[model samples]
Target: MKRYIKSTIGLCLLSLLFISHKSVNDNTVIKLNSDEFNVLMGHQGSLEGSIKYGPNKGNGFSEKDNDIVYGFTDVNDKITWTVEVPETADYLVAIQYTGKEFQGQTPDCTVEIISNGKVLSTALRGLTQYNESRKVAGTRQWFDEVIPLKKGINTITFHFSEISSKQIKAAKEELDNGIPPKSSASIAVKDIALVRPKVWNAMKVRAKELKPDLSWMRDGKYGLFIHWSLFTYPLYGDKQAFETFEWGVNTFDVDVFADLVAETGASWVTFTTCHGMQMFPAPIKTLEKVLPGRTTERDLIADLAEALNKRDIKLLLYYNMSPRGELAAKLGIEENPDKWFQYLNDFAREVSLRYGKSIAGWGYIDSSFSAYVMNMPWEKYYRSLKAGNPDAVVAISSHWWAQYSPFNDLQTSDSGGSLNNPLDKKLFEEGGRYEGLQEHSSFVLDGSWFPKEPFNGIIRRDSNSKGGPTFSEQEYLDYFHKMAKANVPVTVNMLITQDVTRDQPFVNPKSLEFMKKVKIALGK
Candidate 1:
């Protein structure tokens, strides 16, 4: 959201140098673009319309150089704010924006309030941006609306479009002829003020509520997790890991995967979405933008969701985060925690929005990426993960080894304990109720998550079977019995030894047989 809009016209600038004509009332404004507690849902910082100082527009650099927010072209591109108000009341949102419209693009926007599930939006009759070179000269009032805000925290989202493909095409042609790309779409927000709301019969919205019910997760004590990724297949000569990874994704058969999980009688399955090398099985635009070839052409995630849902099984995603690599650096995310959070949040938004309804949960695959766990914006990241599907639960298993966090729905431990393992210390010791976040833990069924290929034939030769897959028959059942008694959700990771055995990623026949019995033992 814009804090102030100053006229940059040469004549207006010289004559009004002393007199101030600030655009809007700053006191009643809510900082929509502020990095404090806002998330640019589906937008990237690299594509911002940085045309504030064009040829003959400005002579020198100033503190207010990049003072405008731009590019609301993509349908998903939107700015969201979690605002805190004193009480429930009617408020007027006064939007100020300058946009160039062509090829059917107009001064149009969709204002969404997820809190109340309402949309109060409008479109200007004429073109909002009349001045091409002068940005502030194009500043005009967007339609006003008295929106009713709830008390406490309210999430307001703005999805808008000011520039069209025609303008972008023209700008591209201009770029070839010694001109810059200035016909970029933008969001020039002004202010929000308190107002008396008239009786509003606002149209209902499809935004889901954040009240997630994980009764299925709690009841279905056993969850099957598989680390099936590009690593599943060996790399051949001159083959990049990603290229082979795409083959793995394309070769994956969702029906076979569903049958494998069904054989175990597991109600939920945690499949790796991004792992060791950060390869995604679906065409996530955000991932593609950061690094080409990291995403697959097939929508494997969606297919998996369909197959699992058909069998009454929940699809949970495992996000192995390491957002400090070359891929992330290209996304303007370096060592900075905020930068890391921004990229991750954008990624989560796209994934969540796409598969929110079909998917049930997300797990930050245990302290697996500890080296790059920059002080993440947990709250904002959580919010973005629920952007499309509010009812989906999350498990912050990794990162800080955080057992329980208010930001997520499940508290997890990758390091399983002994007979009395997978414990929620807060509930057991502090006598605290695990209200929103439930106690959850994961351990491998046998060997390790990845085969000894990366281990270079070096494996843990010890007899330590606490969390490893060396448990005796009794130990396995006993573990589940204890977990069921304590009412904690536990995930058992299975090692995929071969790909496309019987047209499916082959799991150990014994583990599948054992899990079927385990399900019967639990009497679920």
Candidate 2:
């Protein structure tokens, strides 16, 4: 029968009993006795234990914790326990075998243990992989070890270093952050079995099995960013005028955009497949009737995807976590959170299934707005994309979870003064250093949001643009070069407008030329 239980104490304790009675061909005997199971301090709930074959197996073993705990593994396995002695002396310890279920190993854990809170001597302090997986119960059976203890009056430090699912995640995250993975925090203590040691072994091993080395991101530093929107049309006035929220009024020229990317010599190019208020390929009959904003008639996404693919440049699609479409309202899922997750999941799945290997990653916009979209169980969505394209990366905007949440493969920043200022620079630098080791596969830089000429109040327009030097090629080069010095990969916007003849508000012949030169200067 399928059983669901929480807590590692149950799993480890139960494994002790089942493994002992299985009568295996190997002569290895796992001894779990009570003399070691009486260290538990509980007030209310009853503790239950169980050990299953694995995530795939259905049948396993079970146990319970009342006043004492029980555990068993290969004879060579070692468990460490830390206790704070009031004074320090020898104390008589014995097992109270009164329960209906009892299974124990030879030579109880009372081998003349002495302690000074400084030194601990155990015949063996860690378990081997063969004994752990074949005899032990849990996810990461390969990485479990006994912990060293430093005793004190108020604190008894117990180590639980083991291979388990949770521990494996910690190791990966720590590796990404460039820190040593420790097992003390991942394990739980039951009665006598210093369950702290080897608790995380299961987690450590699992992480290694799923992910591959991420040394590729450490080198590629520059990529071209193509902001494909309805606003890529020809305009008058300032050549960069189309570089505003007004991109809706513009029509993108796909052929020109593709030619520009190829000419620019960018190793990778990212395009906005969907954005707020507009999409390419003319107004959809459904959106035209329902959505109130301007719509386009061109399938800009399809055009650019094919164009970029032909050039062998890596492609990444940008998706808004918070959609501007009627789909959010139609599902009546706004504010409900859980429903919104389902909607986003479906949308992302469809996007990945269609684009698949052609795309390298999805740029998540407005991801900082909510935790559900930013932090919660979004790994499933990431895995969905990976399933479609095994090598695809998942990039989120602006240090979304760098501080106190799960880290993404990519870090983003908006060069807009608010987030791109010196303060942001300091933050990213520190975060970059911290994450450089663990997430050696990640990148951090500007290009998190729409780079426009101060439209919709999101961007602050320059006060001196009226009298100062008009937007020039040199300024463009300077902009990109500044980003390169920060050790961050830069992705700037190239918006498509409605009119085919007008220059984009922020981009013109001069700026594109400058972008080319800047790429060369950076040797990208």
Candidate 3:
């Protein structure tokens, strides 16, 4: 099935028809990565694009294979790829992209498939902050939609619109007035994947992750963990909890953090959503109602998930309860534990729904004592978190019930990597208590997950004085690989510092370098 017609309904004012006069007949997968994309810049706006791969090439992933098509500023910009299916069926059309061009706004884009001169499917999607960036579309957005196709060469084009002539005029006026232009809509096309029903690991719920499965984590081996919250803020003589968290929330760059993590070759990340304080980086209505001003409007968690998922790394959030809470006491939270938890559970549901399978795992409430003492419904809470995507692997504090808890999928335990709980089998063994549970052990390399008293978010100290790791490089790798091969997951927590002035967070540079070495030793 072939058609001989050069036409354009217009993705921009002049659709960039990247025509490849070759019919893709293989059933494996048709991928239009950075190398092969032929961009024909239409005569419209300032649309400059080329193949960008590795080192600041813009598609956040650090790997060379994660190349992207940069410079699609015009709404009419369309890139087309030809695919030949086995027969008339549906294919998964996933695009890998970045939305920084939109500057945190939704890029309502168009995607249409033409088969034999007729439109098969055309969808106008109000995509979540996404840039069609991966085989699974990264953020579980509609960019990973299913398109019906006829058995033969089918033309698929991904397009973005906005930045009309009026907006361009406005931007010109702003520039004339010595003001920065704010109305520029652009997107980087990483790659377009046309996959068959074989299903991408992070796709399909995944029959949406429909049932509990830990295979992905077990195989993932080890994860890079970082904790940044109210406690990390430099206090006493520096920025306090709320103040530091707010700054980190606003200034933290997901692209930088994701790139660093990708450079480490770690397959997963366990990011801190809350530690001693519930300074979450997402907008949760329930958290606001429970503790006003506690939640952020930025949706940092979602942004992180999108970025990490783009690099094929899984995300597991650490939602903790403060060991000692004077402020919480004053707020009367202890007086109504059940009601308080109800709000927290709702927030978890919201996070799960927004990120979906992109967030493959979760590290729920830290202390077992608090979970039980507060009468927190573990089963109910578990269900609420999984409601958005049921297949998510959830961990509970290593309680005796964690072994048999119907709602819990993994028994989680944590330590300072130097406490009574050492980083060994005992870390996950729980004194022989976890007889029948998937073991999880997370510990800090800095001896402290968050920066200690005087040397907090606002201050920096010598690495030696910071109470760093007790384990040697070989010791860490030996234990990490041993249990990882046994399907027992490990998360190595590294402390982070907040650059309040710069609105940036710095994970330990030495530790990150070690991770790169670890990735090599592990044969990643």
CA lDDT of every candidate: 0.53, 0.37, 0.52
How does candidate 3 fare on TM-score? 0.53
Model 2, 420-446: lDDT tens digits are 311233223332212321221122122
lDDT of 2 at 323: 36
lDDT of 3 by residue, 385-461 (tens): 77677778777663322122234666665455632222224323321223234666666776666665546433333
Candidate 1 — which pairs collide? Answer: 71-185
Question: In candidate 3, what residue range of length 10 has the lowest lDDT sum?
Answer: 36-45
Between candidates 2 and 3, the one scoring higher on lDDT is 3
Error of 1 at 493 (Å): 0.3
lDDT at residue 243 of model 2 (Cα atoms): 48
Q: Tell me the spans in candidate 3 whose CA falls farther than 4 Å from its real position.
A: 1-211, 234-237, 322-336, 399-404, 418-432, 454-469, 500-505
Candidate 1 residue spans exceeding 4 A from truth: 1-211, 234-243, 365-375, 398-405, 416-425, 428-436, 454-469, 501-505
Error of 3 at 81 (Å): 72
